[model samples]
Target: MTQATAQTRAFVTGFIPAIALLATVAPAHADLKICNRMSYVVEAAIGIDDKAATATRGWFRIDPAMCRVVLQGPLTADRILLNARALGVYGSSPIPQNGSDTLCIAPNDFVIAAARQCRQGQTAAPFTQITPTQADDGNQVAYLAEDSEYDDEQARLAGIQRLLVIAGYDAAPIDGVDGPKTQAALAAFLKSRGLSPEIVQSPNFFATMIDAVQAPSSTGLTWCNDTPHKVMAAVGTDDGKTVTSRGWYGIDPGKCLHPDVTGQPRQIFSFAEAVDADNRTIRLKDKPLNWGGATQLCTRESKFEINEQGDCGTRGLAATGFAAVDMSGGGKTLRFAMP
Candidate 1:
């Protein structure tokens, strides 16, 4: 099989469903969308005061009109805290890269701060700080009551399976639980795309995968950001100095604007020599080439040739000569041609 096909297969084998549940419940509304924008999803908890409270399993919605924290879940407990760092809602600090030093904030601190502000009839802060010890406190663990409703794992599995299939993976039917078959398919797909299969199993896997697929191309030959207005050349002068310009011959007004010329058309020419910044004249590579001279060089050298309009051209040569025929402006440095 070809390399592309092999990688595609590997990506399909290692897929896994992401977890959507969190320990803390937020208010019910439409404006609040969960932002799990990180590369890794993490499990967290919410605590009210020093006590751990069980929360309902549902999404949070923040409504600017009502300005209230509405709770919608299996459990109707009014006093609670929310803990779901994976959603990027509540966290102590930015997630760490190589270690866990930044994941020190506890859910309890957030809950207490919210409660205190609410009771005092003051607006609650967006986030609050929690200590490591308070984060580990068992009292902050909330338990779901018998009446509390939660999302079915089976439904989640089905949704994940459907998404995988849509992403071009041939995964099995949705089962609430993860299985070796699903893992194999995920692995195949990740490998094909040049990503780590092991990371795909993590909570942030889907986020990372989406980022990679949506990233812009980085090839230097293409214009920046794939815009059509830009053009680039790899030509160099004979003195080992490379000249890159935005448009044809680095002479278009839109391509280059110097004090020397106002609106010069793009054209290529051969020069006898060029003057440097210190006013020293430097000889160019080829003799002053008219259309005939350029055509002659094109025939003599197997690699050297004249392109359209009889401009000197070279194939695989390290350097080239560039000249501007119009010396309209007084700038001496810009008037000369360089080899």
Candidate 2:
């Protein structure tokens, strides 16, 4: 189905009750109304062409005899003309032919008429998509002339009331109902918050309130495990340390232990052949090279002797007889390695 056909079907299926209710209660002439028969409320207005009659949904009441409409919502006087179109009333449209011809009808009269018509298989006329008129005094005057065609001010008021609730303001529940109390409360809220006190334009006030409440905190580190699989240590000679006659040397275990240099210290002892915490013996020849010197002895140089059970005694090698001797004058390196 076409979009227009779909909309009409939806409106017929969905909105019959509200339209019916409106039809029953609205006065024929003085009471002008726009019933939001849809699931959502719509801002709207109503008027007749050539008649100064206008009715806004929640904000204004029209007196056809007086040729005047009293606005209770937050709309500027000028914008009211534009808002009337949404009420199914537009420039120079004749009064609805089916409704009562009372000189003045209550706002509810229009609502009830619309509702009754919609229920009895009447559909709103398809909207003619008119190009916006060129900016001319005549166009402007024509636009204003049609202002009385609908009750948009009331629709705007109803919308404002809904927005106020959504925005957390203490407004009355929307019942397609309006009164002095509702108007007074809205006026107070707008005045206190420095908004225009009128209903035609008050919807933005509530929108601003919602924004103010929500705007403050609208944008918001991670860790991972990096552990080692094995721990190792190394022993090497520095020029600053002393070397014994037996050529025994001690390197401090705590000073050079780190991931890059050596793994964590497993255990500490005096000789290259000492067993680690796991009870594995340190095999001197299999030990990886330490930072101090080359792993292999030079050609013709004696292989390094490592003492496994050496103690720092007055005579060291005589007690253990186990030491890695680098017969080359330069020192040999020792490190922890898998046996």
Could you say which candidate leads in TM-score?
Answer: 1
Tens-digit lDDT track of model 1 for 305-325: 233223334543223333433
| TM-score per candidate | 0.24, 0.20
Model 2 poorest 10 in a row by lDDT: 217-226
Error of 1 at 15 (Å): 24
Q: Residue 57, candidate 2: how far off, in angstroms?
A: 30
Off by over 4 Å in 2: 1-151, 198-339
CA shift at 22, candidate 2, in angstroms? 14
Residue 316 miss distance in model 1 (angstroms): 68
Question: Residue 2 lDDT in model 2?
Answer: 35
Measure candidate 2: CA RMSD.
37.5
Alpha carbon deviation, residue 202, candidate 2 (Å): 7.8
- Report the Cα lDDT for candidate 1: 0.28
TM-score of 1: 0.24
